[model samples]
Target: MFCRDSESFALFLFSTDPRLIQTATQSGVGGVVVDWESIGKAERQVGFDTQINHDTVEDLARVRAATRARVLCRLNAFGPTTQAEIEAAIDNGADELLLPMVRSANEVETVLAWVNGRCDLGILIETEAAVERSGELARLPISRVYVGLHDLAIERKTANPFQAIADGTVERLRAAFEVPFGFAGLTLPDRGFPIPCRLLMAEMARLRCDFTFLRRSFHRDTFNLDLRYAIARIRRAMREAFARSTAELEVEHRRLLEAIATADGYFRARCEMNRTDAVQAASQ
Candidate 1:
């Protein structure tokens, strides 16, 4: 079972390619997220495409046979086919089920009724509605809650998806839930993203996050490095960051907050400009 602790764990997306699963297992990641949710028509219609987009039931079975690492299946949101999808995932050997775009405590309850302790249950917090009702949602019996940066950002129309991390949204969830919670995806050290990979890891450590999803950026950046080495390096950095003195951590935290504020301001300005342009176009 995934538990909240000082030690953090990484979960990489599982692919249909057996080699990828073999590599991730050998690479020291805690688990692989089999993304059935992302490949669904609903998600694809919204432009969520990746190199790998098909169901991986057979691949998931192979992953179970090939690796000791945990296998987490991300099922589609509560919908017409939800029960069937959940059953298929379990039949294919998912150790846990991750439900995405969850909106209400009732939804969690409904899923829980279906799950009935077959495996661990995880939910993605990705809507403004979800955030507002997080306190109620957190009270449900679930293993973990992962903050979905992309969806939440789109829903909130924020400039930076990672603003939630610096804006205290995640902190509020942490206070409400005893189960492990995580926000933001991670990449390799060389990927200079909106938030520096190291800084993100440091912040996650400081927040005592139990786990995070390793995104495509990790695969691209660590192409040359051995997977295990890359994973170990990140784990080490997070541990060291967490072990830093309180004063040093505080300074880094302040710096990260400032960066987030700047990004948010930039986004807001751009949105205002777009609105102004639309108004002028309509008038003319």
Candidate 2:
């Protein structure tokens, strides 16, 4: 297994099922995420197509015992339970702690103080404020950074959650950090919605992304198929990205941004139509 900072394309699978974890580890996954970062997410993402996981510290221990692969635990934002959460995650054998929805440099620093080098650390950039202060976060000894596309879209109230990838927000953050960087997820190379996974891989290659979580779409797409073959296709696509020339890279990126913008327009129109319907129903 490569180190977290290695240039290899690390694929993380989010699951608490030991059977799935065993399969994923056997098939060359970088880590299995036991996500516990669900505080206030439901209210914040209301009316949005998002689901929150209520994974517990026990799940961490379960997954830890299930595989020799790395286990990354994503803790909720800073709050009363943060210290206890950090302690529990470490005690349960988390190889790394990913602090999500952070709002300040102090929050990152606080996690660092609490962890005290017990394990590796990472952060999810999910807010505008966090993006502004990310350069500061990167200077610290964090393991990696993954941009939380869904939460960031909700925070900014954008029609398209992928607007950051289209608008260079992710790239700017990537430029600031010397550590490994990634955003979005990968399923099959021939699959993905709104933005095809192939196009997204081109962008990842363009940005030199070091890691990505395998999205839920991947699970559904690969359930009956060979997991190793699916992962190989993804890795092969990432390599093919580098073979494209500068002009080719820009053209592929422009096509991706155009697709996202088109989706954004449709989403806005649908929201507007829904508002009109609501008004008509109220006045009737």
How high a TM-score does candidate 1 get? 0.84
Off by over 4 Å in 2: 1-7, 269-284
Clash list (residue pairs), candidate 2: none
Single out the weakest 10-residue window by summed lDDT for candidate 2. Answer: 1-10
RMSD per candidate (Å) reads 4.9, 3.8
lDDT of 2 by residue, 191-239 (tens): 9877788888888777777898999889899988887778777767777
Give the residue spans of candidate 1 off by over 4 A.
1-12, 39-52, 264-284
Which ten residues in a row are the worst by lDDT in model 1?
A: 43-52
State model 1's lDDT: 0.74
Q: Model 2 lDDT vs. the true structure? A: 0.84
Identify the candidate with maximal lDDT: 2
Over 246-278, each residue of candidate 1 has an lDDT whose tens digit, in order, gives 677777788777767766666566656756665
Cα-based TM-score, every candidate: 0.84, 0.90
